[model samples]
Target chain A: MSTAQRRLDIEEVGDVTVARFIDKKILDETNIQIIGNQMFGLVDEDGRKRIVLDFTNVEYLSSAALGKLITMDKKVKAAKGKLRLCCIRPEIYEVFEITRLNKIFDIKKTQEEALEGF
Target chain B: MRAGLVEVGSLVPFQLKRWDPQPCGEPRRPAEPEKSPLEFAQEMTDREQFEIFIPSETAAGQAVQDRIIQRLEARGFTDRDVFGIRLSLEEALVNAIKHGNGMDPSKSVRVCCQIDTETVVVEIEDEGDGFQPEEVPDPTAEENLERPCGRGIMLMRAFMTRVEYSDHGKCVTLEKRRSVEGE
Candidate 1:
């Protein structure tokens, strides 16, 4: 979904919190880097809003990146916000399904749809 | 089984094979059976021998995998062989980069994959201080069922003949004995 370096950004959608991760795979060493797990946003309240992760640029994700998503999901749910993944790449989606994590996450085709979901 | 050379950046799990499915990692693969996991690593040099540097970063795992796969394929590596190698190498490289270098993209990680006359050898080194292998929790053990830190190590060990840590634990050397062609 993404087309550049591994990165993260923040945005707001209809009261929803969106954290955009550059599709760059955060390798343990070279090729990429992992800043930390809390790279995603943490909202403090629950409304007709959502906490979305824009995977539009993320092309490959390792377990480390997956770990960050898990940690972020926990924080989002704790704050009563839903963790929604947007524009996930098909290959990475294969990885998620292989790891059986597809069942635990809210994967959406677009940001607008995820926001509308709530 | 003949004169062949491949790289994984180069990848660590150099799954040496000729035919078998789980061929690369098995301890007792036949001489050019369905596959093989031959090793060819030397320990005279420092841990730096186990490092690598990839300049351009690509987020596409398939592309990354394809790059390595095609390189190996030209040298006679099959799809199954690549899969096993990818799994083991990914685990080792991931650890070497993350735990060893602390995930610093600026600092390159070292990886040495040797597929020579009789074995498949993979050595990985990071630019960070190493830990005592003993101190790391064992994922296969009952106590570490849910922890994710050491599962890769366990999996790597399973897929390779041996997994050893050095450079005070920051460098890892993985190997699988090589098999000859129809010996």
Candidate 2:
């Protein structure tokens, strides 16, 4: 329902909501939906469109999770806000590379880098 | 009048009766043993194969993918190979459950995995009406870059060396050759 109730660990930095994925593996369909909903809630319900997704703790994620990221990116942009992703593991970053999502999203090396100018 | 065992290759054939129940008077033979498609596929492989059937419910695809990844890892696959297999298998299962079965809890998705010395093959099948894989838009295309859907099939093709669809697109088979170092 709410972003706080979901598995994602959300924190606010300035006008941006930095959400950290706490799950080791975010491959399951249910977890994908939960995380997606949490991100969507931030943009739609809470009206906090500027966001940062931290993937430092995530070990693995499915293509469905990638799809969710794309969705969130579009949603945040449509709301006149920005969404940045940072701290993605190398292996996980390969998925984005393969899908060419790295070019579509604003991915940075760290949270501070992603938060800058956001 | 007499019954005799007819061995067909390694399969044990049923004894046929000469007595005919139909107008054709053909020898009454037991129906061929029904073999699941997965069983037939496994029979063709010389190494061990793994398979599981899961409902088209939330998170079921991930559970199956996790089990498959574990098996691949134990078989001495490299991390990159295992990661590719895991990602491809997850995409296939998700497609089977979401696109093929439409996330209907009553429907089920079947996954069969076989690992040989050279390659790992996985087949995923669903119960719903199939779709045309060719019609899926390219996610990498500039026009479609922001689209959330249509990326699963692309990722599956990217991660696996070979990807094929059959049974009217209801079934997808993914194959990844094990790295030379893994062998």
Candidate 3:
């Protein structure tokens, strides 16, 4: 359940844990589980609440990944933490828009923008 | 030694040179070969269909999406169309493996993808007793927005031009039209 072995680049910036997904295609269940477990570890184990996911490199993701994001969002909210996403490619963002998840998550144009409010 | 020609249906004739003796008391019947998913695929001049059988496990859906995208791109599909196809295909495959097949690795999800110039069609069938798609709650509803279970079907319907389910909800067919610029 440790985030250390995940395929995400994790960095701490002013109490905000910014995790950038390194994979271009997060389209499967395994990757989704990995991200979900890692994010859960960050919240439950590490107790780091404020998090930003940088999707600059992610070109595509399946609904399974979206489901994981929703789980993460709910966990963070339950713990009084914040979860935001930034740098989503338009194609991937369209999936969010179609499913109306764009309204649920605090999506920003850049990682700096996401970090600003935290 | 005996030699004979065995012709099975439309398949090529098999020349049997010699028959080996059974190792045990009674002759053991040969186990039936499992039918491949590709055997279900239909080929046409205008469109080509590919069927793959994948285990009900994590990350298996991604491989189906990749192959469909490659075919779509090769057929001159736009990036927008490819994106839509990928998203819808992923959703269908996930539903087949997780919801339909219950993530049992012993169960195999069958996927058939047919592509041509104007549209891409995909069908995913699973081994589980299917549920009614109409019964799935609306994810866009305010109360349901936070819920995660029903959004995959919504995404597939939203992205695909048409979505149909048959075989008591065990099979879903999705279709998406190719996007042309300036239209």
The alpha-carbon deviation from the true structure for residue B82 of candidate 2, after best TM-score superposition, in angstroms, is 1.5
Q: Which ten residues in a row have the lowest lDDT in candidate 3 chain B?
A: B1-10
How well is each residue in B21-125 modelled by candidate 1, as lDDT tens digits? Answer: 232344774454443343332221111222245422233222333454454555554444444456656676666655666666676665555554334566666
Model 2 agreement with the true structure over A18-91: per-residue lDDT tens digits = 99988887786777887788778888888987789999898888877887888888888898898889999888
Fraction of the real A/B interface contacts present in each candidate? 0.04, 0.71, 0.71
lDDT of each: 0.55, 0.77, 0.78
Which regions of candidate 3 fall more than 4 Å away from where they truly are? A2-4, B1-44, B58-60
Interface RMSD per candidate (angstroms) = 5.6, 1.6, 1.7
| Model 2 per-residue lDDT at A38 | 77
**Candidate 1, residue A93: CA error in Å?**
1.6
What are the per-residue Cα lDDT tens digits for candidate 3 across B128-157?
999998998888888988887678888787
lDDT of 3 by residue, A30-52 (tens): 77777778767888888988999
Ranked by TM-score, the better of candidates 2 and 3 is: 3
**What does DockQ come to for candidate 2?**
0.52
Off by over 4 Å in 2: A2-5, B1-46, B181-183
